[model samples]
Target: MTWADSLRTAWAGMWSSKLRALLTMLGVIIGVAAVITLVAIGNGASQAVASRIETLGTNVLFVTPGPGTPFTTRQVAYIRDNTPVARVVVPLLNSGGQLSVGTSTLPAPVVGTTPGYQALGAIHLAAGRFLAPADITFNRDAVVLGANVSQALFGAGNPVGAHVSLLGQRFTVVGVLQPVGQGPGVSQDNSVFIPLPVAQFLLSTQNLSAVLVGASSPTAASQAQDLLTNLYTNRFGSASSVTVASEDQVLATLSATRATFTNLLAGTALISLVVGGIGIMNIMLVSVTERTREIGVRRAVGAVPEDVVLQFLLEAMVMSLTGGALGVGVGLVLVHLAPLILKTPAVFTPSAVVLAFVFSTLVGLVFGMYPAVKASHLHPIDALRHSG
Candidate 1:
């Protein structure tokens, strides 16, 4: 049969058994709707998590005791002890350092941190382990190598046990952190870490150039920020140069925008999927009843009942396959447009789109089969005698 003839025959049959077609289509409608909704939501949420990982700073907070102008007015007490919102109070000092091994020496930025810095920033250890309390207690001259530092000084060789002199003091290579993949192009891997006390003595700078504070939750970040502001105002008047940051500030800025776009994606997916399923089901059932007389004619012409069944089954499958192909194109377009609409990354993997396409076809075939079989199994005389 020509393609147009097949489609016309299918459409005519579907029109003949409207209610049966509608009922059969229920499964497809629900299945497609669910697939679209669930998949969009799952993908969107996954992308959000990935973005959060990329932008999330290593031990992010604020630079308390600011360098330029009056950065903050919050007091150390509010950040350290009084506020329930703040989780970790990391006081850091930046200073010049020299990584000298054998005859080669390289300049690196030094960061002084409390123990919480490693965990809060999600630092990964490539070799050796992060500094323990013992290192801090004895003021051990141990160092951790950032990925860049390892590459620069030791090349391909392991630098875990190598000794590097920072400034004028020697620090043993206690650990080397795995690379964070140059994310955001931050030179965190090239930096050196030392205990706060050692950094203080070595850098010859006191009173914490910056303080990094963690929050109890995203919500508490702002409250902590505000409280710190007030405390700093009281302690140092307007002259205190401390910055208070809560993760909540970043989230608050993002939630409204993110939610609206996500909902739009989900809604569009649901609407299209349901519509497509209904269309397939309606077309299938109508095609089946309309072709009943043709089935009787075939049986009378010596075609077996099973042959009739297979013929109708093949027609239903054809319709499903066609609809599935169309749905695939539409779904992909939506997935790609998501990034432009949401202003975030719309990661479209071939696997996910293929899964959705296969799912749509299955939805059509399963839902269309009952009506097709009903038409094929009809008694020849009864089908031929029936009115359209």
Candidate 2:
């Protein structure tokens, strides 16, 4: 028989047993859908994590006093729009500072930070808060509590007038900062924010240890790096004093994390596909037995062995392929809709769609092959002798 004739006969057989075809296809569909949905969701989550990190601050960079470099609050100025790019520098002063309300004493991350830290840390005041121009102006002994700190030490107890001990000195709580999570999330609460100048004076270590610099946005973070590097090189005459890390670095780390999850998901989905393929093979084998007499008659009437085999093969392939297609649709829907159910946007990717379709076709071809080969090897005499 011509290939067209074989194709026609195969399709006719599949169409005749619509219910069986549908059942077989279901397995293929599920396998394909599983792969698509898992990968898409993984990628989406990766991107989401990156975005959240970037939202913490822009063009943010850190500096650590290098080996042999003593950290002191130096005369260097904080980098600002007005500070010549090559001339600006800030000393990093990380110290232990004490904050007390009434009799409650809480020691927190005392950063001897330049004024720019106010913007870079996204520090906001919950009450009479944030070091005002006057406070920073007068070099006042004042303090601000991170959101978590305010809740614990004050909790609407009015911390504005509260006295806090910094190191050994007494300072008044000037501002109660709205909670800003610790940088890159080291903690959620209880941080003491003092002006960089105040930190330097009290800590009695006047060499800039590290500078926290902010960029306008995540994408422009790299630009800020160049500015910082050039500034450091010009002032320190070396690159050892500063290092610039963009939000992209955190995103890359998160991507690596997602890869681990993807591997796990892929392994599970592969097992499902294998199980589904075995089921298809089993069903197709039974079909061949039931249609033995029919196969013999077709062969006797001029249908070649190849044609007989093609017919059975086509039925299995069609079922698996249909199932694969349906699975893809279901999976894509699930992945895309997940974020919505969780009150977030779904990340749709075209690559995922193509991959899903390709996987489905593979399932059909792989599971359909054995049945086709078996049907093709059948002898007309033996088939005719068999009772359906």
Best by TM-score: 2
What is the TM-score of each predicted model, taking all chains together?
0.46, 0.53
Instruction: Give a tens-digit lDDT track for model 1, residues 1-388.
Output: 4456556655665456666655555444444434443456545554443232233353356645645543221334546777776777666665545678888876566777656677566578888878777877888887877778888899888888778877788888988888877542234676778887788777655566667666766667667677777777676666355445544444453455555655566556555555665566566567657767777887788877656555565556555555555455555666566655654334454554555567666655665567667766789999788787
Clashes of each: 11, 18
lDDT of each: 0.62, 0.65
Q: Which stretches of candidate 2 lie over 4 Å from their true place?
A: 54-118, 121-248, 342-345
Deviation in angstroms for 53 in model 2? 3.4
lDDT of 2 by residue, 292-355 (tens): 8888888789888767667777777766666777887888788767765653334556666676
